[model samples]
Target: AQSVTQLDSHVSVSEGTPVLLRCNYSSSYSPSLFWYVQHPNKGLQLLLKYTSAATLVKGINGFEAEFKKSETSFHLTKPSAHMSDAAEYFCVVSLGSNDYKLSFGAGTTVTVRA
Candidate 1:
């Protein structure tokens, strides 16, 4: 079993500036970690994932996440924030590859300023 926590409930950044969303996870077995983003009234979109392949995983829209086993963290970052980046983000964790159970974080709301 695994669980995830998004450290910040809300984050605000200026357009064209860097953006960061913190996430931490706990798992009993090897886990598959994923970051999902959802715009208002839209389905969640996959941002990135880490499945024990690489410690640093890059995703669409210039987003990236680094998995740190020692720190038990998988924080997401974007070099430059865009207006479209304003949305809710979730941190998800699943147990084994075949495991159907997925734990999700509460979500972090990102607000982009001009």
Candidate 2:
């Protein structure tokens, strides 16, 4: 069985400060990991993905994550936080290709203090 755990339920940061959101996952096989952000009453936006390819993956909005197999972790980070970055983030794992079945971790809500 595969599952993901988000370390923080909520994170607060001042605008322009660095942001970090931790996630840990367990998989039976090589897993496709993703970070998705959801704004108030909106759909999810892909932050990044680890698809058995690159260890360090760069994403939109100055976000990035490193896939650490040994640590069984994929943590999202940003150089500076923006007020618009305030939202809910979910760590997800895909079971297989062509299958949209995604297992989502309990979300982490980011609060950006202006």
Candidate 3:
């Protein structure tokens, strides 16, 4: 089985400050990891993905996450925060099989304060 755990349910950041969202996972196989962002009433956009290829993966909007096999963690980070960065972020893991099922964490809602 493959599963992901997002440590923080919510995160607050001042405009232009750094943003960090923590996540951990456990998988039977080398699962694929992804970070997806969702704006209010908007669909999900892929921020980044790690597929047995890269350890440090960069995504859209100046966001990046490093896959640490030893710690079983993939934490998202951004050097600066913008008001537009306020949204829901989901940490996801793909069950590497034909089912193509995705397991999502509860999600972390980021609030950007001016």
* Number of the top TM-score candidate: 3
What ranking emerges by lDDT with the best candidate at the front? 3, 2, 1
- Show model 1 residue runs off by greater than 4 Å: none
Error of 2 at 109 (Å): 0.1
| TM accuracy, model 3 | 0.97
**Per-residue lDDT for 32-80 in model 2, tens only?**
9999999999999998999988999999999999889999999999999
TM-score of 2: 0.95
Q: How many residue pairs clash in each candidate?
A: 0, 0, 0
For lDDT, the strongest prediction is 3
Q: Model 1 misses residue 104 by how many Å?
A: 0.4
Off by over 4 Å in 2: none
For model 1, residues 1-114, the per-residue Cα lDDT tens digits are 578989999999999999999999998765799999999999999999898999999999999999999899999999999999999999999856565677899999999999
List all candidate RMSDs to the true structure. 1.2, 1.2, 0.7
lDDT (0-100) at residue 67 of candidate 2?
A: 88
Q: What are the lDDT figures for the candidates, one per model?
A: 0.93, 0.94, 0.96
